[model samples]
Target: MFYMSTASGIIFLLILFRMDLGKYCDSTSRTAKAFANPLRVKDFWVLMTLPRFWAFGLFMTGVCGIYAVYDQQFPVYFSSFYPNPEDGIRAYGYLNSSQVFVEALCMLFAPWLVSRIGAKNGLILTGTIMFVRILGSGVAVDVWVIASCKMLHALEVPILLVSAFKYIAGNFDSRLSSTIYLVGFQAAQSLTAMFLAPVAGYGYDHIGFSSVYVLMAGVVGVCLLISCLTLRSESSRTPCSTVPDHAPSPPATTAVV
Candidate 1:
C-alpha cells in the first residue's frame, strides 16, 4: 500500500509538471464560464421536471442498487460453495481480484465502445448484460457457472462508468453537468442503496441469496424496459442541444462554448 501510494504520487507529480494546460484565458476562463450559474434553484427544479432526468436516474438506481446488494451478499453466496470458511474466503479473494484486474483492462476499451454505440445504447447493452449476469448467478448450481457469471462485471461496470456521464451531458444542459451528476445520478444511487439495501437484507433473511438476487434482477429488468421505451436515441458522438422548448433562449451576449 505504501509503495503503491508513493508510485501514484510520483506519477501525479510528473503529470503536473509535464502537462501543458495552455493560457488561463483560453482554458480556465472558458471552463469557469461553462459552469457559471450552474445550480440555481429554478434550474434544479426544471431539471427535476425533465423526463430524461427521471429516466436516466431510474437506470442508475437499478444498476447501482443491485451492485450494492451484490457487493454485500456475493461473498456469503459464494462461501456456501465451499465447506471450509477459510477456503471460501481465499477463493472469493481471487475471484474479486480478477474482477478488478478485468475491469481495469476493460476501462481502456470503454471510450471506444461508447463512441461506437452512443451513450443510450451503451447503457442498454450493459444493462442487458447485467440482467443476464445476475440471473445466471441466481440460477447456477455449480461454482464455475457462478464464477463465469460474476466475471461479467468486467463488461458491465466499465461501460456504465463511461456511458452514464455521457448520457447526462448529452441530454441535459452542459453548464449544469455537476448539478445533474450530483443530484440526479449520485443522489439517486445513494438513495436507492439506502432504501433497497434494507429490503435486500430482509429478502436474504426470508428467501435466501439466490431468490433475493433473482428478485433484484427482476427490478433491473423493469428499469431497462422503461429506459428502452423513454430514453432518447442518438447517433454516435452526437452533441445534443440541451435547451428545452419551454425555456427561453439564452441572451445573445451569452457565450457559446
Candidate 2:
C-alpha cells in the first residue's frame, strides 16, 4: 500500500511538472543536479562538514526518538491506567480522535504563529512542548492529566513540521532542499528509531514506561540546548542562495602529475 501510494504521488508530480505548475518550483533543477550523480563522494563529504547540517540533523534525531517512543508506548501506558483493558482501549481511541480534530484546527493557525516568532523560535517552542508532554506523562498519576498532555500533539505536529521546512529553506541552499530533508530530517528520524528503539525496549522491560519516558525527556532537553546554540538566528539569516557562504570552501584542487 505504501509503495503504491508513493508511486501514485510520483506519477502525479510528473504530470504537474509537464504542466505549467512546475514553473513555480525554481529549485527543481538544483535538486536534479544533486542526485544527478550519487557516486560523487565529494558532495557527500561536503554536506557532512556543514555545521548547520549536523545541528539540525541531531535535533531531528532526538525529537524523532521521543516521537517514536510516544507512538509505541503511550497507548500501552494509557491503557494501563484504566480499570478494564477494554475501557482503556476505548478511551484511548476517543482521546486520539479529539487530537485528530485539534490537529486540523491547529494546522490553520501554524502559519500565523510561525510568522510572528520566526521558524527557529517556533522550533524551540515545539521542542519545549514535547518536553512538557513527555515529562508530564511520566510523573502524572491521573489518566486525565496524561490525556491533557497528549493533546499537545495537536499543536506540536503542525508547528514542528512547518518550522523545520522553513528553517531549512531559510538557512540552506534552495537547490539542496530535497537532499537536506531526506538526510537531515527523514534519515535522522529513521536512524534514531533504529538505534534507540532497542534501548527503549530494554528500559521498558527492566525499568518500566515512566522511567523510559523520563530518560527520553532528558535526551530531548539536551537536544533543545544544542539547537539553541547551533541554529542560525532569524535576524542573521541571508537568502537561501547565499546561505552557503558560511561553509568552509573546498581545499584548492592540487594538481597530480
Candidate 3:
C-alpha cells in the first residue's frame, strides 16, 4: 500500500505541475539534439546558471526525503496509533483527495508565481510554506496534525516541481532541458533515500517517530538555510545549472597518444 501510494503520488504530483512526458519525450529530445546538441542551446546554459535552480533542487531534496523516508512506515505508525486501522486508512485516502484538489490550483498558480517572482524567489517563498507546514506539527502528535501536514504536501512537493520546470521552460528551448531537469530531481530523490532512510529507520526502530520528526525538521531547516544562501542573485540572465548529480561521462578516446 505504501509503495503504491508513493509511486502514484509522484506521478499525480508531476501531472499537477501541468506538463507531460508525452509518449516520445525521450525520442523527441534526442532527435531534436541530433543536429545541435542541447549544450549548444544558449538558453539552456542561461537557465542552468540561475542560482534558483540549485536552491530549488536542494530544498526539494530535503522535501522529498521527508516524504520518502516515512513512506515505508507512516501507515503502519498510524495504524498502531489509531484504535481502528481501517478508519485511519480511510482518512488517509480522504486527505489525499483534498490534496489533489489543491494540487490542481497549484498547477495554475505555480506558473504565475514563477512568472511574477521568478523561479528562485518563487521557490524560496514556497519553501517557507513547506517549512511552516512541517514545523507547525512539531508541538502536536496526533492523526489530525498529521492529516493537516498532508494538505501542505500539495505545495511542498508539487510547487518545487512546478518551479523547476518554469525555470527550464523560461530559459531553455533545448531538447535536453526537460530530460536534464527531471533526471536531476530523480537523482536527488534517490541519493538521500539511499543514505538517510536506513539511518532514519534505525532511529524509528530504537527511539520513536517523534525523534524522526525532530531529525526531519532539523534537516528541512538546514536545507532552507542553504536555499536562501544559494537561490538569490540568479536568473535566466545568470543561470546556475549545477545539479547535484553524477558527473558526466568521459568522452571516448580515439587512440593512445
Candidate 4:
C-alpha cells in the first residue's frame, strides 16, 4: 500500500510538471478576472443560497455515508455468516473483483445514460438502485446474492459521479464550477464519512450488520426523497449567464481518471 501510494504521488507530480497552464488560460490579462480571491466570503455564501446545491450536498453526504459503511463493515458482515474466515475472505475477494468489472462497464455507458435520462433523473435512478443495493446487503441469503448486490452498487459509482459533474457544468458559471463541485460533491461526502464512520462502527458492534445496513438504507432513502423534491429539471432551471461564450467548454467526457 505504501509503495502504491508513493508511486501514485510520483506519477501525479510528473503529470503536473508536464501540464501546460497556457492551454487552460490564454493570457494573464484575460485570466486576471477569473482568479477571484479565495478570502472573499460573499461569493461562497451566494452559492450556498441555492436550493439545488443543498439538495446535491445532502445527496452526496448520504450516498457517501452508505458507501463508507458498506466498504468498512462488509468483511465483518460476511465473516459472521460464514463458517470459516478463509471462505469469507475468498467470497469477498470475488465480490470485489466483480465490482471492479462492473464499474469498468458502467464507466463506458455512464455518459450515454446520463445524456438519455438527464442528470437529475440519472441521479434519481442511481439513488434508487443504491437504496435497493443497501437493503439487499442486509438481507441477502448467500454469497452469490451479496455479490449481485455489490454489482448493482458498483453501477452507482460511475452514474452518480458523472451526473454530478454534468449537473455542475450545466448549472454553474465556469469560474464557480470547480468550487461548487468540490464542496458539494467531495467535501460534503468526506465530512459525512468522518461523522458516520464512528456511528457505523458503534451500530455494527451493538446491533449487528443487518441492522446497520437497514439504518444506512433509511438515511439514503431520505436523501433520495430530498433530491426528488428539491432538484429541478435542467429545462426548468436557468443556466449561469456570466460564463463567457468563448470560455472553454465544460468537460463532455467521463472516465474513472
Instruction: Identify the runs in model 2 with alpha carbons over 4 angstroms from their true place.
Output: 1-44, 242-257
Residue-level lDDT of model 2, residues 1-257, one tens digit each, is 69998999999999978887456535445445444433344555676788878888878887765676566778888998999989999999999989989999999999899988998899889889999999888897998898998898999999988898998888776656778999998888888888788888899889988888888898899998888888876798655552333333458998999
- lDDT at position 82, candidate 2: 95
Q: What is the lDDT of residue 66 in candidate 2?
A: 63
Top-down TM-score ranking: 1, 4, 2, 3
Candidate 3 lDDT by residue in tens digits, 202-254: 98889877667666777777887787776553342533233222335458988
Q: What C-alpha root-mean-square deviation, in Å, does candidate 2 show against the real structure? A: 7.8
- Cα RMSD to the true fold for all candidates: 5.0, 7.8, 10.5, 7.6
Least lDDT summed over 10 consecutive residues: which range in candidate 2?
A: 240-249
**Each model's TM-score, in the order given?**
0.83, 0.80, 0.66, 0.81
Error of 2 at 4 (Å): 16
> Which is superior by TM-score, 1 or 3?
1
> Lowest lDDT 10-mer window, candidate 1?
236-245
Off by over 4 Å in 1: 1-39, 235-257
Model 2 clashing residue pairs (backbone):
none
Best by TM-score: 1
- Please say which candidate is ahead in TM-score: 1 or 4: 1
TM-score for model 3? Answer: 0.66
